[model samples]
Target chain A: MNRRPTLWLLLSFALVLLLAFACQQFTGAEYFIDSSSCNGCGECIRICPNDAIYYNQSGKAEIDQTKCTHCANCVAICPNNAVY
Target chain B: MLACALQAQNAFTLRSDAQMVIAQSHTGVAGLNRMSWEHHFGPDLDLSVSSTLNSNDRIIPTNVQKLWHNGLVDINYRGTDFTVHADYRNTVFGASQLLGLYPTWDPLTSQKRLMQHQGTIAAEFDADFLQLGGFASGKILRYTPYTLDLDTFELVRQDNANATDVYTGAVIKVPIIKGLATHVAMDYKSGTFADNGEYDLNKLNAGLNADYKILGNASVSASFDWTKRTGAAISNGKTNLLRSTLRLRHRFSNSLAGYLLYINNSCLNDRMKNLRLMANYLRAQVQYSFPSDPTGGSYLLVGGKYSPENKADAYFVEGDYKVREKIYAGGSLNLQPDWQALISARLSYYYTPVNELHLQYSHRQYTPWNNSSLDFGANYLGVGTSFHW
Candidate 1:
């Protein structure tokens, strides 16, 4: 029974769900912080473990879109690389 | 007064890292090494050390040699809110048993040399609505003593395993209304397996969470968890699990934001052999920044998963830029479905203000199941430095 390798694994799982639905219908993914090289030096607000950074009002360092989980550990622990 | 004397000054930091890795597959080329050191003594102690090295260029085990070496250490402490940590690790690896496609080139899994050691201790305490923690860990493994020139299997007697683990957890936060909050937690686990005493293990878990704050940039969270596990070598003889999670976040401005996540899991086992397992997962993401340059940024993620005969989907997009002020650049692209496609790139340079230098690259393609299609590539050149006082 060679159903063509199960029809090529169901056409590669329907082309990975049609390219993940065309990448969520054209883009969207969150994580940001770059107040001009953030000098708010909160060190990503103490490594924000979901306290999702803070210090806006031009103090720079904001990042609390519902408590970031974009896990990048504050963009690799921003050392003035300013979270990205 | 200079921000209160710089918030009661007391800062010190030191960091150092080195990396060199080159990997290529078509059955050849391999070299990897990493080094690290970190220290901080302000805001409560800190220390770290790391090392890893691997090489044994693959290609039909010419005179056997499949390398690995690893070491790690970390220590941390924080007072005035309590926190403590300690960790140690050691590994001397090379244990394979064919898990497929270049499963490090099987042959009954490259002959022995697997020694591992681990140690851990943790503690936590926070009071702003109560929080607590506890942890303990231990591990030891050995598996050297094997010989079989030119590899081709055959060389047994690799047994040595030890274990000891303990955990205790706590959490409590309440504050409903005006940006809501409610969280509860409990956890316990114990493990023992000094030479496999029936693989002893135990676990208990409990959870409840809720966080709300819709409007003013939105926020939502939900959680539920329950777990119970027992030993007897744990293989569907005693297990129970239930998990649920939901999350949603929004912030349509300040350069945009968005997120959504969902998870579900269920498991049951033993009742005279009645095992079951279920799973579900969903993810969504959004992030953007570039509004007149926020040092540039980007994010895009998509996810899906369901089980009971598998179902999966994935997507990815990432970006970063700072090309001004100490050079920085990033990129990422990933996809899934038998895993095919993965591209990565990075560039860094900070050379002052705490040193840095970096370069990275990645390329991957997959389709395993004896369906021919495997491409892998990696390259990393690194240099790092840091010092603050």
Candidate 2:
């Protein structure tokens, strides 16, 4: 098997990391849930370390931006990839 | 999870809502109404303020009203690894556990309230491979029954029913290897009861935990803690507690996984050396997830546990099925040999991007302690909606 593709993928990942690092000073990353993709599963609400996320009346989970510590727990745990 | 996300410092967010919950059973109808507000300010120096007002009729045998207040302030300097926070909370909520520590199910009856006023401050220093943090908190609790005086016909305020707790703790964590971390934590706690000063307490606790990832897919974690508590007002009175837990998890396939856990707790009281208490529990759980598709996916979890102290076994099973992405239904069931079984189910529907509706129901069947011939249980059903801006 040709190793070129694997090498290119690694290089691309490194390039993206480098760009992210370079752009860190100008713009920071923020955490938000994409309501369009949210399933209202309430999993994120249960696993939040800060209890910063709650089920809105709509049954969808929303992040309390003030209480959120930017822990990214919900982002990692969301099965639908809804939290950003 | 970028901490350096670009955000304006002056930005603010708010959530304000009103909710009504009604539970119906064979006996009668119960109603609950609540209003809440949450506000946040600033990005660099964040401040959060929240409040809730709750009124309930038939939660217990009577009517109850409560108000809650919570606030938090966090300061994180730009381009630094130091962060600090302070918070205050006053809450009157349903009691889950006895004395806030002892595990009991008696609180399930009535609108038993555990009122707490607490304040805390903490600071942390984050560095590569290592982290250090410390915190101090104080709380006052009013856990006595809320009742009216039979003679005076007025609300009776138990003046000496309060308990005050002060605690200070520190923790350190280190990453030892790839996918492995270890932590050490220590704390000192003091408590005083207004009713009986002789029950005042001073306690010391220390704990260690280890986390390791195995085979890049499996994980193992272990935690151990030791506690020594002494009655400050009484001479030669002490209690020692030891607790340990071990958990192991692994994935069998793309959609199947399982975990095993063992927990042991033992306490020895100097005053009751003959009555040393020890409890051991072991549980095994398995989970399965279905392949995802446009119509949606589903997952199932089942677990069973054995307790030697009670000579009883318990089983739990939970599952969630997503009918496409806009609607989902889930339910959980728990059964124990000695007591009753609990069943709960919930359904959610997403009408739009910012609107949602949810319905839930639960039932628990058991025989009352006093009335052995009769089987008694409770049923509850609730519906709620969420709207966002």
Candidate 3:
């Protein structure tokens, strides 16, 4: 079988990746939990697949910035709408 | 015979769900639709392609919309004793706004998006008495970070949330007795963030699981796992976890049945310093069900979950009654801690065996244990429809 088609496909994929990376933008804004609104129901903790959210000293939910992947799953799962 | 052969070789399916939610804070509509196609090369080989679209306006607080689109392709092959499977998925998530409280937040100005690509492959072999399996999976996430200014689009920081994760695992299962089975598994996971090396970590997991059946109605299952984390990450620590569950089910008569379930999860070691995790979550639930009417479309359930860790107790009673051949009415009442309660009623109409429409109303009251001024109540009215073919 000819390998030209496979080579071309790989080349195209690499080009697309390069373009996507070049056009991407970033900022310093981040999501935080409103501690006053948090009910400590543990719903966000259970829904975070990365284990980034945990209980604080006050038993309120807190997000570990290092482990957070910005999936926004906690934002959707929090019944009290604490995550912003 | 030809039609049968064709049908066996190819199959297609479509499913869609649409819901409109009306709440005190916001009103929104959500939709999810999926389409899948499968082709069988032979009895032992097959391929499938699936696409899904999901969108919700109330996913975030106070009126933010999120849309997710995903595509997947999977292939499987089975031989005499071994099977191989592989799949790839690409997903995109877009948000209409970053923050509802922000003054500059707008649908077009402060939008965000994320793209993810994931691939997985697995192989398994069966040896009559035992089974062996292994899998490897990888994912790449690219997030469009939040912006401070919408007009100038000034990029101040690199994307810290962009990450890649790789995981591999192996498992072996053995049958010990007629109704008992045991399995041991090991997994290794590694992850890296694009701009933050402090978030990079490597983890190893080893676990054992066992399931046993006592007689025909009672079963017990348990698992013990040990996890070790290394690297510069903040969660670098070692933890041991044990989980066990016991379920007992019985049928008292032709129309009445009951089940009792108890689950316990505990951490064996307390060495983790940075994370304030839940040490234990113990819950027990007992549920009894009985037919409400002779037409068999209705039943009543009474169940309660009691947690000893935080005094979080919940009790619920639910029932559904068939009002007509195509219509049904159902309601439930749930009581929780701190005087929190939820009461809901639903009416469902079935147009066909695979299609349904439902209207539901729920009222919820939440009061925190410490603060009574933070108490709030909300009412929700939802109408949803599901169609399948």
Candidate 4:
């Protein structure tokens, strides 16, 4: 009949649920490469862990949508600021 | 005359990288060699052809040596407001899980023999205030594992993880203000496995991004993505994933800069009892450089990660120093719960702008989170050289 302990446990469970909900957000974004700004350095291709990036006919870097795991490795490695 | 014109318009490069790796069980030599030729037909059109060869036995845990190669052809056209590009690649290689940020928990490792042919095309149009782009890609993968057929008195290729994947996506971006921009994109992906239809899957992803510059020297960007996957192989035949990232970058002074990044990954409406993917990661770094020397710089980075579902926490610290103009050294230490740690050091000499000689050493002590008795340690020493012209 320790009501205090039950109250504490319930409060802790509520806090955990609140934290989980707060962490989930709808603020995610998509990534793309600006073809005009791309300089064909191939750095993005080399750093892609999933092998999602490749060169297109115009010699510019292009990302394969299916293979891309949305890791954003290409966006971080692009030197010309082409990836967004 | 034609040969001279072609030679004048073409640029050729050949690069070779060789590393001698010393590991506990074996001492192996890994090599990568590439040759590429690019020719500019005009200012707006270009074509390139490249070939690469690789031989490495140290990537996988086993000692089964393998050599592989790939060839690529690419072409591009850049117009005033529109850009078009296409490429094709063919590769034959042995695939394995290379050493990465996350340690493999399973001790048994096997290489998969694979051959792949991929083609992609993309186009982008810049409409002054808004940019729009779309791309489509297709790939075919063939697995090559042969077994002796007792009935036919011949060899038969076993059905393995062969699959074809198709992906298409489109994105549009709009600049709202001088320092603000937003974008929305969606993509569709499908995969068909040859061996098992139950493993086939289709995925759809939609995401949004916002970027803003706070001041002249600082910027902030955030993104959120939602993914829906459906397949018979998936747990409960369906799943939903949500991922988000926030990044802040600031240039404190002429010689000082830093950045902070945070990521949240979660699976919502989770019904699978055995699988859960939820984690939060945070990383911060500060860099300082000598004002007078462009090449002299140093940085310190620290990161931490937590997984509520798995009850795991990981931390890492990485730093580097220029030491001098031509010599540089760096080291990193990573620690995870259950006594898992990795420590690595690297030193490099830059002889010229496009040439480098380096030595790297790493030692890893790994213990599975669920199993403590399977603990093991590995040491790696690599000496490599690279040159470009």
Which structure among the candidates has the greatest lDDT?
4
Using TM-score as the measure, name the better of candidate 2 and candidate 4: 4
**Candidate 2: tens digits of C-alpha lDDT, residues B1-389:** 00011112232323233333333343443333323333343444555444444433333321222333333333333227877777665655542222222112122222233565666777778899898888777666555543456677664434335556665777787765443445666655555433444334555666555555667678766656556666543223226555556677899888889988665555545653432334455678888886772222367888777653533356778887776677778898877545556788978676853345778787765524422332246676777665443
Better of 2 and 4 by lDDT: 4
lDDT of 2 at B275: 24
TM-score order, best first, reads 4, 3, 2, 1
What tens digits encode model 3's per-residue C-alpha lDDT throughout A1-84? 235433433443343334323322322223456565577555565445454564543336776544666556575455544554
TM-score of chain A of 2: 0.64
Candidate 1 residue B47 Cα shift, in angstroms, is: 39
Name the candidate, 2 or 3, with the larger DockQ value.
Answer: 3
Every model's TM-score on chain B: 0.25, 0.66, 0.68, 0.70
> At residue B315, what lDDT does model 1 achieve?
59
Native-contact recovery for every candidate?
0.00, 0.00, 0.05, 0.01
lDDT for B218 (candidate 1): 76
Candidate 1 lDDT by residue in tens digits, B1-389: 11122222343344444445454444444555555566677668877676766554442211123565667677888899988887776666563322111121233432243455556676777776666666555544443333334555555444443323333445455543333344555544333322443434456666555555556687766655556666653446236554556667898887778777655454456453332434345656676765644434323333322221222344567666666677667777665544345666777665653345656665554435412322333444445444444
Q: List per-prediction Cα lDDT, in the order shown.
A: 0.49, 0.52, 0.56, 0.59
Which tens-of-lDDT digit does each residue in B83-152 have in candidate 4? 9988887776654333121012112222244566778899999997999989887776655444546677
Q: Which portions of model 1 miss their true places by more than 4 Å?
A: A1-84, B1-142, B145-199, B204-213, B224-288, B292-389
Arranged by DockQ with the best first, the candidates are 4, 3, 2, 1
Give candidate 4's error at residue B344 in angstroms.
3.8
Q: iRMS of each prediction in angstroms?
A: 21.5, 20.9, 20.3, 12.7
Per-candidate DockQ values are 0.02, 0.02, 0.04, 0.05
**lDDT for position B368 in model 4:** 54
